[model samples]
Target chain A: MTAQPDQNTAKARTFISVDAMGGDQGPAAVVAGCLISAKANDEIAFILHGPEATLSPLVSKHPILAERTTIRDAVGIVTMEDKPSQVVRTGKDTSMWSAIESVRSGEASVAVSCGNTGALMALSMIRLRKLPGVNRPAIAVLYPSSNAQGFNVMLDVGADIRADADDLLRYALMGASYARNGLNVDTPRIGLLNVGTEEHKGRTELKEAYDLIRKQEQKAGFEFVGFVEGGDISGSKADVIVTDGFTGNIAIKTGEGTASLIGRRLKEAFKYSLLSQLASLLAYTSLMRLQKKIDPRRVNGGVFLGLNGTVVKSHGSADATGVSAAIKLAAQLVENGFNDKLAARVAAILPTEESPQE
Target chain B: MTAQPDQNTAKARTFISVDAMGGDQGPAAVVAGCLISAKANDEIAFILHGPEATLSPLVSKHPILAERTTIRDAVGIVTMEDKPSQVVRTGKDTSMWSAIESVRSGEASVAVSCGNTGALMALSMIRLRKLPGVNRPAIAVLYPSSNAQGFNVMLDVGADIRADADDLLRYALMGASYARNGLNVDTPRIGLLNVGTEEHKGRTELKEAYDLIRKQEQKAGFEFVGFVEGGDISGSKADVIVTDGFTGNIAIKTGEGTASLIGRRLKEAFKYSLLSQLASLLAYTSLMRLQKKIDPRRVNGGVFLGLNGTVVKSHGSADATGVSAAIKLAAQLVENGFNDKLAARVAAILPTEESPQE
Candidate 1:
């Protein structure tokens, strides 16, 4: 979809705040990604934060990017090695901090970063702060699945290592909002991640959260599908899978590792013999299609939800395609007004002071 | 490896008590698997438990199985739908109970069942009882990994939802012993499963478990590798990954689901066009090799460790191949005297009354 016409007259254009440094591929890839997003959507604009000298040459190479982007100079960079606590305390001048500042200052609709995950999360939480009644903010990611849209939303993927029942309930509401806005599902089916689907299984907090989520189905505008096992994460049964950050973090990584292992072995198999190499050539298109289906780079953004503003985190190792995907996700969330809708959803089902605790 | 030939000469053979019913594929598959194991290893014998009429026909069809197996009549069956508590309370006459009874009575070296996991675990714990100083028993399963043996041990797949620091320590000791016996790892590297390898990350218990497992490195005959993430589960970095049953169960299933999804997509890719189909034919051998590498059926059994006697739980949906794999694992455990070694290992590192609580 090209930039919407009305020449930016009917509606205000969305400006995405981007941290162009600290990624594995550096500012060049991030700048190229901004150009790609800008070329795709005319209504898109960028507030690029980085070492201005380095990013300026890259942005100037793409004339459209130079015209549509506003570069902000930042003296510091948050390396992947920097601890979250350390970054939060002393990373004030970092590009990551400046990127979040644009959102915090209401100069940008959303922020996209390919920095250290912990630092990005800590910085985002500290700057924008959690929404009212949000005890824990979660990172919601879309996973390739056999669903109608070929994706499922899973949340709490490493934001907080611990989550109580109330925290999990908020994840359900936030994840549902993400699925609805990000994935375009009208009424997402939300499932609590568990070892088993039976009501008697999993931790006590999960059962408590299960009951709480069930109570929110009508007002929350989603379907509560009960407990979903790990298999359901990729299966078509659930549109949104919610869990404590600890389990979600491990499960997502495990999925990634498993996919990579198989892909590596498949490559080895196709290169084993002369005839196999010939076969690989013949099956090139099909192989590319399969690769596209499973490539982690294609779906590269993890939305840090429950915060006052939206932040999309691309993988640090992401190339141009990955960065562009994160930007596209941020733009979509902005167009859908996801953060405000998520706040409303969370506020509706949030636990009251009089609610009993397990 | 063939069975030891001193069958009736130097020592009594290892007899694995088998539950001949309650599997998804019925008695035929279980009996066929027993026959395969007995034929491969003359030293392997079976105390097959099921209804006399049904199991006799299946067992008799395989002459070798009939010869090496001693039929034990069990009037009832513990189904997949049966609750663990219900089975333990009223399943005395079932094959699952009878199978575990053989181990408790010293009539069998170990128990192997292709039945309900929860029911099998419940029966095994009730009959064999927990080992001394063990707070909770864990189910250890070997996952396909890039390690030397192409497998790494992970526990508790679904024995208990909760694991305190002490329970995790026991899992480490037991898992290490299982790796030594099952995978023939000389000095298994025990890793505490967490969101990251960093010491300061994850929940309180994981950090506590990390400290506990570290202190047992020397006495437990294992190497402490500190914290490991989900990617390490499939990586060669750690030999035995320890976690609570809740996380382990979910991770294992997620891995299984992921592998299956990739496998299915690969098949689709190879059949997308006539050229790809011809390529599939030319690369058939390599594809088969790749398939075998990631096949869940090849790695079948989940060993319920930390009990007075050993019990191996096969996948309920296992075919003859899966059942044979489980039986082979049980035979290997018996041959290595794994249960005794595990008990001794736990008794050595188990926390005492004076240990400080977290």
Candidate 2:
């Protein structure tokens, strides 16, 4: 039967290792996120890696997934409470470890975790190693930018702290690749976060990086549209904005806070008494649509790039829906041959360049 | 005749030096903000510092405050477009510098600027110098916390970038003083920002700082309540949150972004169609009240404590209302004898056991 199928000349489906014990709500939320993800597409298969004692019974509850999902027993589970170095050291037998190993050994195309982030990243670096021609990798998530699609992708949310000029250029390249293939865009534009749009503004490092990004754009065939301030992080002014984890984290939090404060303020304003509640009923649909658009849960996951394998990390406080969306994304990224394509493209370009080699 | 009704004995009226050309809108907006602030109180005198060419006519427009507001001729205005260090180096006749000088020479108790911050700060540090026992001072802004009064305070928002363990302790001390004297709290609690709340969760520097803050709290008289995460920046968990300028800036931006995003989304959600516009009309009065409660303009200014002379920096984008509120705050800080009280408090206690000189 294998020979007969091989003769048909079609590609084999990609496999993903999912750490079911990784999220805030543990296996239940992860399983729910996975189920939602699995429901969206029928082509993807998952290897659930975790302690059999706790997870075997949990998976048994869903009869439909019995065939589509299989288990890889792991002795440990990385806890959110664990210290960074402590988790990295202790997670060898954990689900996160097994999942990363699967991707490394060619058994799985991608791995997904919503676990102790510092641990996941630490172990991931050791397990898969960085892609050739890349230094430190970055984690990027979708933020609601007031653009046509209602979101823009921002990188280096937490992965790399002290990124230099080369690292940023690489981020721009990877983000461009992701936007093109993953988001299905034809041309992706990159912007540098700054106090002002003038080329002369920003710190020395950013200025140097700006020049490098511009030079690379001139030759590397991506659009570099110049600098963007905090005000434009919300919209069509730019596509992929690059900044230090320090600023990126600040910007993200600021955006999140502003969204919450404004929402609460507006609610309090329109919600004086019983009549205002009635008024809300009339405007409820539009509100729901916008809420659906900006809800963090909907975009609750990020992709940690530059690792050897494709690993999707969900937000620490993600619920079932968020976890599910991450699962679907992990499945899609692996299915798209993310690593193979990115590696091929990088290898194709970097040999002639002066960058240090693997 | 020289005593002029014994001004010192007659309730010690406050004097404020206002940066007439600091903000984005310049003299007109500053003048407008002053009008509202002037309306709120009657015992304050404003020493407006800026180019006479631009400000003289603006002051003339408000003939009501010919006596209360006086225009001092300065050659230039500090432009946000200029580099902070460059402006400080080259612009002596600038409005920001003249305003700062006015404060230092005791012509004004407090200097309020909406000018280029780098220049403003440089001028303050160069002129007024530091308070005794303070290594470096920080700009502590009272942000909306989950307190009963709907406010909490954070420090070093954008004052200094490279804050060490001792600097943070100093910030905490000053913030505590501001809380006790300005906000009127009996015992204010302090928190240090880290990735996690656990004792062992921060970086080496943060851990080092954490230990010092704790040691100081126990050994000294300060109330040290443990570590806080980014989420705690909003909630009523701590009265004073201290972090480096980098983290503090991030926290502040995150808070601002969240508030603005919520407001934007609400407007879009509620005003989608003509009928929904009618809904907004029905709840207009309550919305107005909520706006008054949460608007940034109402809490326009932030005090730059720990200087020999009091200084406040309003947001560059601050409108007429924000400027007015800033002026009122400067007056209050001066009238309350901020410098004398802080100095006395610092002197009363032992060096390490001393009250924070906010």
Candidate 3:
């Protein structure tokens, strides 16, 4: 039986479409993450996509999740090895596709998935499509920083390998919006990533992007701090760093590798001798605090910007905590109306042309 | 009058040209570093460039340094703020220029400087010129890694923003040579930096470079590991990582920034509470060992390759230890005949073309 929808109750509820397979631990981790998220936020609901037989049992393990979830049968799974192009052509029955379709059909406010990044992005682009005036969609990520909010927004982290001056300008606009709504920073300071802070440095395209982004200071509602170097990514220099996908992708990976290297060295140092072992025990509390502060799982989402619907990509190897963190981020973005506001902002700034087909 | 050179003794001696001014701490650190190297190695000597009045007193501070150093008068100091273009026009009197001229005129085997990067590279290109068959020169730096040798070599860290297939091939050749001689890596494994390891990933130029580099495995005397991502830079997977200057520059800077951030956070954790403060005291020895292992000063020089003469760029803010490390690297390269060997390797692999003037 259908009942009349209560406007206040309906507005308060937020539905998240989730791909319940393809993560490192399969559907179990995804369901566990959803349970954690649902317990934390009572208003959150999910439309889980995967093989109904496998996902339903996992959902029933948590009574609360079983009450707040709806399972959709999707037998096909997009594995990490699947090519993005191939996925686009024949991935309609996969959980990733079904999850994205829910967002496109307005059945869910946002989509979150722990799957093949390339395939997920490809399916997202093809299904949700780009917003009007959007040249190319970008992947905006949160980098640990010494800022008040403890994070900085960096964009184009492997969504595309190339970006012209105009694309960079669009990144600045969308990245600033994300920093404002997601990171809760007002008038976010945006910087163009380059080899040096000097205006004469870097590629010619960077110089042109600098000029374009500078002109949009008033309209885009961001403080253009000119060009910033790589150190600014972790330093308290800027709230948003814009770069082409190639450099950003490499830079982010390099940062992760360095962190891992140092972390391994630190552990070795702590285990060097009995005295050091005792010291580590005494310092356990503070060490745990430091570890929690830098845990990658706490910041697991890479939001796909410049698209009509919001899509959050969780790390492929993410555990339950990481998946929950991603869902939390997606919920925050949905509540803030990030996609609609970003689309409106882009439309207002750039000259309207025929929107490109996916 | 100069005495007749004793063939064996003269061949054993290696002269390093040092720019003793415009560093963060000026001539004192340079003189101190030279003293350390002079005492540590009897065959090393220096051509110290700076105002004699300023450098003579510092050289006298260490009696060993005074005996091994030859002071040259260069009144003009190329400050860090000097523009590269401006320096090219009228910087002949600067210490940086004089130091490089020593190598150019065959008075010194190699040049080492802690001055502005752009100006130093500009002067080096103008004075040393590119080796025949070389498209563009690259800056190769030793990064701390988990390898048994404790380092990996990465190139084009900020030399030029672009690298074609040929340029990348040259980087692989040059980088492998440095890894063998500088890091003592035998038959070094070279990896091309990309966003992913897949053949289909990265830009069009990278795929072309992959194919070109693959053909040079036997000729260059190195193993090609196809494509590697940013994580491989610090991992033990490769001895040499090569990429265009733009990505390499950002990657290196991001790595440094991440290390700094983690180092700071660790120190904060150690000082968080009274119990942790006590633990810090107990772990001082192991902590110091860890610090010494990852110290930037131990690997201080960035060797400029693809040029006729060797030029080493020390960090602008290098201390005495850092300067000594750079000098040690230059001595090793000179002993290995790195420049001559690199030139021969390039000629053997590619058709010789008319060299381009800077």
**Per-prediction DockQ:** 0.77, 0.37, 0.80
lDDT for model 1 comes to 0.88
Residues B166-216 of candidate 2 have per-residue lDDT tens digits of 778677777777776667666788888765577765557777778667766
Per-candidate TM-score, chain A: 0.95, 0.91, 0.95
What is candidate 3's lDDT per residue for A1-358, written digit by digit as tens? 0111123344357889999988887888888899899899987788899999898778887788887788889999999999999999998899999999989998888999999999988888888899877778999999988888988999999999999998999999999999999999989999999999999888999999998888878877899999988888988899999999999999888888888888889899999999999998999998899988888889998999998899999999888999999999999999998988899889987553234222
* Docking verdict class for candidate 2: acceptable
Write the residue-wise lDDT of candidate 3 on B263-352 in tens digits: 899899999999999999999998998988888888998999988899999998899999999999999999988888888888877642
Interface RMSD of the candidates, in order:
0.8, 3.1, 0.7
TM-score of each: 0.95, 0.88, 0.96
In candidate 3, which residue pairs get closer than 3 Å at backbone N, Cα or C atoms, i.e. clash?
none
Model 2, which residues run further than 4 Å from truth? Answer: A1-12, A51-64, A87-89, A194-208, A225-232, A261-271, A344-358, B1-11, B51-57, B60-64, B133-135, B201-203, B218-221, B343-358
lDDT over C-alpha atoms for residue B31 of model 3:
85
State each model's CA lDDT, in order: 0.88, 0.74, 0.89
Write down the RMSD of all candidates, one decimal each.
Answer: 3.3, 4.3, 3.7
For model 3 chain B, give the 10-residue run with minimal summed lDDT.
Answer: B1-10
Candidate 2's DockQ: 0.37
